[model samples]
Target: MRYGTRALLSKALLSLLLMAACGAQAHFQELIPSTDILTAETGNTLALSLKFTHPMEQGPVMSMAAPRRFGVMGPRGQEDLIDRLRPGGTDGKRTFQATYRAELPGDYIFFVEPAPYWEPAEGVMIVHYTKVIVDAFGAEQGWDQEIGLPVEIIPLVRPYGLWTGNLFRGIVKQDGKPVPFAAVEVEWRNDGSVTPPSDPYITQVVKTDANGVFSYAMPRSGWWGFAALLEGDTPLKSPDGDSVPVEAGALMWVQVRDMR
Candidate 1:
């Protein structure tokens, strides 16, 4: 009998341990814009609304901050940023929502982590992240143009973390028609730092294609300011042999000149 009792007690303790483990795996659900594709003007403020299957416990501390600890990597390998979702005051009917906004034009990713009290037993916590592309022209015009230029900077595969490239493409309208350029000159700066390559692990330069489209690439990653030169006094030679300025948001020049 003594042996049997001991065995039973051991089983009970094991079951309790398993139950506790299950309880610790709470997760999030019902995230709005689950795949949030925010196409907002540069200066416009937007909110990211999130809902969950389970209500978050009141008074639990939450946090929202950019993820920077992870090292810079290509688009596929980059880590997502974590933003804490705070209860935006309860609705009369008990529904809850949280919101966030993009203040600049570029790519941004966001994720969420719930506090311990909000977790559920045997459930997996969900972390959601998405890339948002903000249009710079929207900032000045307050509206997105149908034929506006879009720029993207991509990194090339290189060793020693130093090889990168950039690509620029836009529609230039002349006589009410589309004139596509294969290349253009691009100039960019980091957040108040005049250091070479700005963010250390990146590269920014003017690039052109046989069709007059422009592009640039960086070896590193960080917040960067950039502009395109349609036509200007060329200070430096470009890889495609075009004279252009390294400026930010200069695509308008090309449109204006073509219109003349």
Candidate 2:
């Protein structure tokens, strides 16, 4: 084999790997509810959609496996609702859906611990601890409670009942401690009405302040997701039996409505 040929092949592999890493960074694990606020008109049975995808891009979705845990922290207590999840997807991409019946008129914080996803391109195992909140019967208690995820975003502001342009704040935590200077990626779940003029418009980036808190003022009225990723304390073994890095993300979802 010629040395020049080997060098060209190596450069090609590096380029391919960089492209894959950028693509994977755009992917987000989404856990959005049918409605952020539940009322009698909407009924007590709430439906939830769980998908791993680029919220802004919308179509380049990745398949998601059954989560390690899925449940809610209601006003009464934490309830394990994993059994309610059913297999689902779009265009053959795997996903999950579940229905939860709210018996109380209080805030229900729904959360999911996704199975670690292997990204050969990025060469890292990704796990997103995602959550969303639904206020039932106008009782807003328990929206601020943390579910103790490996990485979590504790909302500093009320996650629901917001109009477009309202500023949202949260603290990024890993292993129950503040992660100062954490990088957070924010995206608006596109409804096909908006087109990204360029790649940079698809996702927004923000960094936490000295106190591990980050703020973003949502300009559009729709579902918005924020993901703060950090390296896991321990590495995980890859399918090839080699040690690889683990990326843990603390994610939360919120909805904003146009002031009409």
Candidate 3:
């Protein structure tokens, strides 16, 4: 009887662990532009989409409240774009969209500071500081400039204009200092055409090196997002009014094209 009880207990524990693992899909804050490299042909106005979801899984997008902040830093200067955000959704889940017309030839770094998201499964609040770069008229300047997000991925690469299989690299920074050995998650924006064979195929995981640098090569064409997830220094209150840890994510979106 004792042995049978122990077996049942062990089985229950294993089942619980498996359940937790299954629920732990990587969450991504997507800040994607219509075209990374814009020209007269593509047009001057850039359409951007914002969403909280699992990119590779192409999710069940989590509901996103209006972000705390949204803007762009261009060659001239920073412009607040919060007022232009239009509430929208995909598959019934909340999302956002905005548009910006680039008049001059330079890099426009669009960024967002989202409100705290409470994750019941992890018992934590998540805040992703997300960014994407759009090059205007082939200027290609300022793609590497840091906007100083609370947690940010400073791209070592240009963040745009790349062929498939090009290696993208960046440094993970927290509070303006490099975060050595930070955990980074990489996912492709699946278009409902390709399905991952397994859970591992959904999100590829990588870690920063001793110098806080992480790199990943794109195996497919489309948008790729690199998210450096770190624990915030301070905890925030959950919806239940409990103090919970914060999962701070510094995310950057990049695009790669297949060479025709």
Q: lDDT (CA) for every model shown?
A: 0.28, 0.88, 0.87
Using Cα atoms with residue i matched to residue i, what is each candidate's TM-score against the true structure?
Answer: 0.24, 0.90, 0.91
Residues 1-260 of candidate 3 have per-residue lDDT tens digits of 69999767754553453234334788899999889988889999989999999888878799999999999999898989999999997989889999999999999999999999988876668899999999999998998888988899999988888999999999999999998887788889998889889887887888899999999999999999888877777779988798766778899999999999
What is model 1's C-alpha RMSD? 25.2
Q: How many clashes in candidate 2?
A: 0
Segments in model 3 whose C-alpha atoms lie over 4 Å from true places:
1-23
lDDT of 1 by residue, 1-260 (tens): 69999767754553453334323311122223222223432233445443322212221223322222211112233333233334443342222344444545433332232221212231212221211222222232212232221222221211111223322233333222332442222222223444433322232334344433443443233322222322111123344454322211122110000111
Candidate 1: lDDT of 22?
25
- Candidates 1 and 2, the one with greater lDDT: 2
